[model samples]
Target chain A: TQLLEQSPQFLSIQEGENLTVYCNSSSVFSSLQWYRQEPGEGPVLLVTVVTGGEVKKLKRLTFQFGDARKDSSLHITAAQPGDTGLYLCAGVGHSGGSNYKLTFGKGTLLTVNP
Target chain B: EPEVTQTPSHQVTQMGQEVILRCVPISNHLYFYWYRQILGQKVEFLVSFYNNEISEKSEIFDDQFSVERPDGSNFTLKIRSTKLEDSAMYFCASSDQGPYGYGYTFGSGTRLTVV
Candidate 1:
């Protein structure tokens, strides 16, 4: 079974403090995606990174795919209270016929206090 | 923006009872998926549907679990006999492309509580 290990399962920080969450795996992935989920809702896609060593930014958030394609990271800069939520990382392998068959990490629960 | 829609925001059923979770994928999406998140656990993939058939499913998808695209727009997941462990938030999702194509859009989810 492919497993994704996410670090810092719970984070509580003051507003404006930057934080980084890491997702690591032993198997290579064809692509990786980040999602943010709020209470009473399903996850919302944040970004998708297909290439190793690729970096993508969405306003205050930055996502990076590891050079080996086995890991990824999400960094929040000058975090605001609105940034607080559950962050998840899901990986898609190359061999799955569905292409979108995902293996997900446990996720990081972030809380930014104002 | 287009979104995946699910019905019965919450459900409660007795053990051994049958329950069907409904989802309406985006009109233009070609791939459909079902996932569940046990309280405090990671979101886990249950099955993937394409071309009106199941393309893949996880081990958790056992004999008690089945999926069908009953109509042109609706995808349904049926749990033949519910168990306490089946209680979780079931999410329906759809994607324009396969996993490699683009990220999927997920519905708010149905919270199933099996008594």
Candidate 2:
């Protein structure tokens, strides 16, 4: 089974602090996506990395994919209370025929306190 | 922005009872999927539907569970017999293309509590 391991399951930081979360996997995937989920709600897509060693930035959030497509990371700059949520990383892989499956990481719950 | 819609934000049922969760995917999406997340656990894939048939399903999707796109837009998940273990947050999702296409748009989800 393909598994995505995320580090620092829980994190709490003061306002304006910076944090980085990592996601690693032994299996290679065609694409990796980052999502943020609120309690009692489904995950909302944040970004998707399709190329190896690629980097994308969204406001204060920076996302990077490993050269081998086996790992990814999310770095938040000057995090605020609004950035607090469960951040999840999911790897997309072919699952026979035209079907593709997403294997998700356990997730990193971040709490930004002002 | 378009959103996927799910009915009954919360559902509570007795064990062994049947329950059908409903969803309405994006109007233009072609690929549909069902996923579940147990409390304190990661989200897991249950099944994928396309072209009026199931394209793929995980081992967790057994005979007790089924999915259908009865009309042109509504997607439904039916559980013949619910068990305590079935309690979880069920999410419905859709994508314009496949995962490689435009990624996925998920619903708010239905929290199922099996007693």
Candidate 3:
């Protein structure tokens, strides 16, 4: 089983500050994904990174997958109050037609104060 | 802008009572799953259903738990007898095609409190 360990379980930052959250695992995965969850709402998909050493961007958020496929990171530039939420990382793998459910990190709760 | 939906946003039950949590997946999704998160804990996979049956389940999903898709739209999780440990947030999710080996779209969770 792949276990993802996320750092900084709780974070508090002022608006306009930048932050980076890390997700690390000892086992390699075929893919990695990021999600943002708000209270009472299920997690919403943020980004999926497939290739080793791949990088993807969405406005203020930037995601990177490690070359070893065992880690990933999410960097937020000039964080805003809207960015306050629980950030999660999930890793995926499969065999044949079976879609292996993701192994999720505990999560990083980021609060960007306004 | 489609999303999964769940009913009875919160449920409270006695330790020995039966409880069923319901979910509505995306219109065209082929794979469905159930996950749980204890307060201040990581999300844990409970089970994944496809082809009308369970495809995978975690150790946490023991004899006391079961899943059924009685109709075309709703997915349900049943606890034969509730336990205080069962209290947590239960999330239902769906994927267009097995997470595309990618990510899953989760529904707003159902909070279950067992007394």
Candidate 1 C-alpha lDDT tens digits along B19-48: 999999999999999999999888999999
Return the lDDT, model 1, position A108: 94
Report the C-alpha lDDT of model 2 over A1-114, residue by residue, as the tens digit.
438999889999999999999999887878889999999999999998988999999999999999998899999999999999999998888332233667789999999999
The TM-score obtained by model 2 is 0.96
Candidate 3 structure quality by residue, lDDT tens digits, A1-114: 438888888999999999999999887888888999998778899998988999999999999999988899999999999999999998887232234687789899999999
Q: State the lDDT of candidate 3 residue by residue for B1-115, as single tens digits.
A: 8889987799999999999999999979888999998987888889999989999998999999999999999999999889999999999999875643443789999999999
Candidate 2 stretches greater than 4 Å from native? A94-99
Per-residue error for B91 in candidate 2, Å, reads 0.2
Q: Clash pairs of candidate 1? A: A99-B99, A100-B99
lDDT of each: 0.91, 0.92, 0.89
What TM-score do all the candidates reach, one by one?
0.96, 0.96, 0.94
| Residue A99 in model 1: lDDT | 66
Q: Please, what are the lDDT tens digits per residue for candidate 2 over residues B1-115?
A: 9999998899999999999999999999999999999999999999999999999999999999999999999999999889999999999999986855356999999999999
Ranking by lDDT: 2, 1, 3
* lDDT tens per residue, model 1, A10-114: 999999999999999887889999999999899999999999999999999999999998899999999999999999999888433346687789999999999
